[model samples]
Target: MNDKSKSVKFFEQLSWGIWIWSFIALLCVSIYLSVWAPLGNIAALLVTGISFAGFYSLSIKMRTTTKIEGQMLISNKAKIDLKFIKSATALDAEGFKRLAGVDADPAAFLAINFWSKTGVKVELKDKKDPTPYWLISSKDPKRLVKALVKAQK
Candidate 1:
């Protein structure tokens, strides 16, 4: 990690623990089915293991972390320069929904997770990019917006 970079993870570790528990439940179902079906214990385990690996891999990919490094906002889907960012504001649940839904710009980048109801809305200053802003979900929108403002300076 760079000293100047501020990292904010969108999900709590406990939330990720749910995924692990879900995987265990799936494996249990597989084991139970193996007893009544022709698939057998080994086959059931193999199939469940493979499926779980793929599911976990995708879950890891979907987990997003936002990083404020120097003048840039870096994440899985977008990298935006703070120089082009006119403002960063923390949104309430209603504001987040409104900005992400009816009032949203068609060209703006969005990295949203259904679990997170509040977010940070970043307005782009550069007219050439076509994207008016970015709406990114965050567990702590206030801290994220603050970090963005600090990085801008």
Candidate 2:
């Protein structure tokens, strides 16, 4: 019943929200050093290069990925088969806030990243698993839900 070519696959990469500004600040620091400090051209270039590399490494390390590969739904923190999913509901900002706060289930698997406020809640049907559902933060909840639903079928 499965066709690999037609199977729905979605991949999303989420970076730390403040990284861009931090990177810009790094560049500004290098400029300041080059202009104000009595440093050789090679020294300035080396400092800038090393700073950029360090910032880039930090950004990559902090990034998280959400992927739907064939029948599997993969998050940075967890993964589940689409067949085990019973339902998925897309959440807006208010709903996400409430469920993630007061109404949250302790047993739920949270793949929440604080940066993105919108998300999807996936309910599971697997009897063996104690976890009630998965709360995942997604930039595009509707599209993620649609992809999951399509893959499940």
Query: In candidate 2, what are the lDDT values of residues 13-100, reduced to their tens digit?
Result: 8886776767668685867587447876677777776777777788787677788887789988578888899999999999999889
Q: In candidate 1, what are the lDDT values of residues 1-153, reduced to their tens digit?
A: 565444442222212446566766776676658653886777777776776677677667668677775556876657877789898899999999999889988898998876667888988889788888888888788988877776666
Over the full model, what C-alpha lDDT does candidate 1 score relative to the true structure? Answer: 0.74
Residue 135 CA error for candidate 2 (Å)?
1.1
List the global CA lDDT of all models: 0.74, 0.83
- TM-score (C-alpha) between model 1 and the true structure: 0.78
Would you give me the overall lDDT of model 2?
0.83
lDDT of 1 at 146: 75
Clash statistics: count for each candidate = 0, 0
Specify the poorest-scoring 10-residue window by lDDT in model 1.
8-17
TM-score of candidate 2 on Cα atoms, chains taken together: 0.74
